[model samples]
Target: MKIAFVGKGGSGKTTLSSLFIRHLAATGAPVVAVDADINQHLGVALGLDEAAASMPAMGEHLALIKDYLRGTNPRIASAGKMIKTTPPGDGSRLLRLCEDNPVYDACARLVELDGGAVRLMVTGPFTDADLGVACYHSKTGAVELFLNHLVDGRDEYVVVDMTAGSDSFASGMFTRFDITFLVAEPTRKGISVYRQYKEYTRDFGVTLKVVGNKVQGRDDLDFLREQVGDDLLVTIGHSDWVRAMEKGRPPRFDLLEEPNRRALCTLHTAVAAAYEVRDWERYTRQMTHFHLKNAHSWGNERTGVDLAAQVDPGFVLGEGLAASA
Candidate 1:
């Protein structure tokens, strides 16, 4: 299963993503946690020290990736010629998770998080070179490219902490996950984000569920329920332990309050349930929609390639989690 956590900034999506990764790891599940957010704090949240958290960002290695993938292939001459989400054809590169490949090690260094049952990867922090530029687009495009070619088995999982706000919609990143947990507080701004996300993704065929966070009492819960209604999947009550952990204490999943633990379990169950509800036709349609939407940018305008025709012919809804590469 590939899950993404997205919400307005400070809505606690990163915190929930870290905790959920910990929960899966503790259960002996095969999991990969990705800190795709530009802020890059999922490392610390996953119990890594500052030094450990400071791994290479995949964005910084785009040139190497292009060289490795294009490798003597006459079709693709440069990184700009490659489509991030298109599957590799004959003589093109294919990337498999945990496999030995030319770019795998560098990619692993950038994406893999250390310690625990869950492997971690970060997109890396923004640099001074990025000032006054939309360089994060390249960073996120690296992540999208990585995931585009990655192959995972039925028992494996990928959890990504996406960037805050509707910025993710700027790229096809919104279409990459099987389930997107949108964390929202019981406030107007929070609910506004939910509305924006819904409007943006309504036609994308992505499964969206609201995870209410920072609820203080019944009123907060009531507000969330009223705003999100059937879309609200679960509520995580405020926790002092989480606050303390953020303030420099070591993160101990075992010390999570009972309510929070229950919420995590509920989230896990919801994700599992999502796999059972398959709609391949809709999935394919949405995939085509985004492919066509970006056709001019990633295809004709640059490489003169028919990008829509490059959509994975074998792609099936829910199959990403049910089959091996």
Candidate 2:
């Protein structure tokens, strides 16, 4: 299953995501964590050392990626010209995650975090050279492309920590996830983001679940319940352990508070339940619509190409596939 955690900047999205990843790993599940945020702090939360977490961003190596994927196919000349969601054609490239293909190998190296059951890959930090450039777009685009091309096992989990705020709406990043956990605190600003995200994602078929974070007592939980109501999935109580870990204290996932651990387990169960829905036809239709909309807006206006025509053949309009496309 593919899951993304998104919310207001200080809403503890990263914290929850990291804990969730660790929880999955602890249970012997295979998972890959992608830090799609510009701040790039998921590594710290994942217990990776500073240097290991600071690996090169995939956006920095687009040229190599294009060459590897395009191969002998003359249709795509650059990564910027690649429509990740577009299905591969006669001469186009396709990728299976963890496969031995050159493109897969290169992309794996770019994002893979070593030495754990749960691997991590980061979009890297924003640098001085990114001044005046749409750097965040570049990172988001890279992740989108990678996800679009990846083929994973049914049991495998791909969890992404997305950038904060509504800026992600500018791209189709919101549509890329099977479930998007909107971590919201009990504050007004946090609930405001939830409203905006809920309204925006309603038409996209994106499952927006509210994960209440930093709950101190009954009042905080009450606030979230009042604001989020049925949209609320679970609540994570305030953790002094998490606070201390963030402040350079020794790390210990095994020592997590019971409430926090239970919350993570509840989230895992929710994600597993989502996979059973299996409304592939509806999902394909939504994806096709999104592709067509983007094609008209970006492809036709900018490149004179009918991007919708490139929709993957495997995703038939009225048919349900046994596996994910």
Candidate 3:
């Protein structure tokens, strides 16, 4: 299952995502974590030093990634012709979680935590060189391309730390996830992004759940309940353990607070349940919808080809994936 964690900046979405990834890895689950956020702090949150956290970022190697995923698909004449929303066709490469593949081998890093390990990938951080020259979406597009070609199934999880606010709506990346956990604090500013995201994704059938962070007491919980209503899936109160991690003294997963730990488990359970409802057809439709939108918008002019041709009418993600497996 592919899961995304999104919310306003400073709302603890990154922290929550790291904890959830650790929870899954410690349970011996097959999981891959992608840091698609502009801040790019998930590696540090996952207990990797700044130096060790750095890897072959997807954005820095976009052409290589595009070439690997395009594979033998006749629709994509060249890697340069493939845009971010280009969906997999009959011969396009499809990736499985934790599998040995060119994409993962080049861009992913193996980080051992408690019971198991997690495969980590980042969208590459925005740098001074990108100043006034590049938009963050260019980096984020690598993640969208990766998701477009990925074929994850049950018993596997791909948790993404997306850019803050409604930025993901700029591309089809928001529709790529099986579930999206919107981490919100109780403040008005915190839940404001939730409202925007809800409005943007309401018609798309996105499974958007709210995770209340830094709840002080009943008042905060009441505020979240009153604001988000039934969309609130779980609440995680303040944790000293997380604070310690923030201070640079990371602890083991077993030492996390029981209540917070339970909250993580609840998130895992909710995401796990979504695998039963995974709809490859809907996924393909979403990809095509955004692909055409982009092609009409700028992808056609940018690549100088009819990008709509990239969508394969005969390709069924579920059927193709099963046969490949």
Best by TM-score: 3
lDDT (C-alpha, whole model) for all candidates = 0.74, 0.71, 0.89
How many residue pairs in model 3 have overlapping backbones?
A: 0
Put down candidate 1 lDDT per residue, 1-325, tens digits, no spaces: 7789999888998999988888877776777778889798998887667887887777777777766665444545556666555443334464555556755577554333223456667787778977988556557767776665455544567899999898888778787777899999999999999999999988767799999998899999999999989999999987877888788684466888999999999989888887776454565555556556777665667676665655555544333342122
Number of the predicted model whose lDDT against the real structure is largest: 3
Candidate 2 vs. true structure, TM-score: 0.85
Between candidates 1 and 2, the one scoring higher on lDDT is 1
- Residue pairs with backbone overlap in model 2: none
The C-alpha RMSD of each candidate to the native structure, in angstroms, is 3.5, 3.7, 1.4
**Backbone clash pairs in model 1 (N, Cα, C under 3 Å; residues 3+ apart or in different chains), count:** 5
Candidate 1 clashes between residue pairs 3 or more apart in a chain or in different chains: 111-121, 112-120, 112-121, 113-120, 113-121
* The 10-residue segment with the lowest total lDDT in model 3: 316-325
Q: Give the TM-scores of the predictions, in the order they appear.
A: 0.85, 0.85, 0.97
Q: Give the per-residue lDDT of model 2 (tens digit) for 26-118.
A: 776678788889898988887666776777677766666555555444444455566534433334454543445644344443322222466
| Candidate 3's TM-score | 0.97
Residue 300, model 3, lDDT: 97
Worst 10 residues of 1 by lDDT: 316-325
- lDDT, candidate 2, residue 201? 86
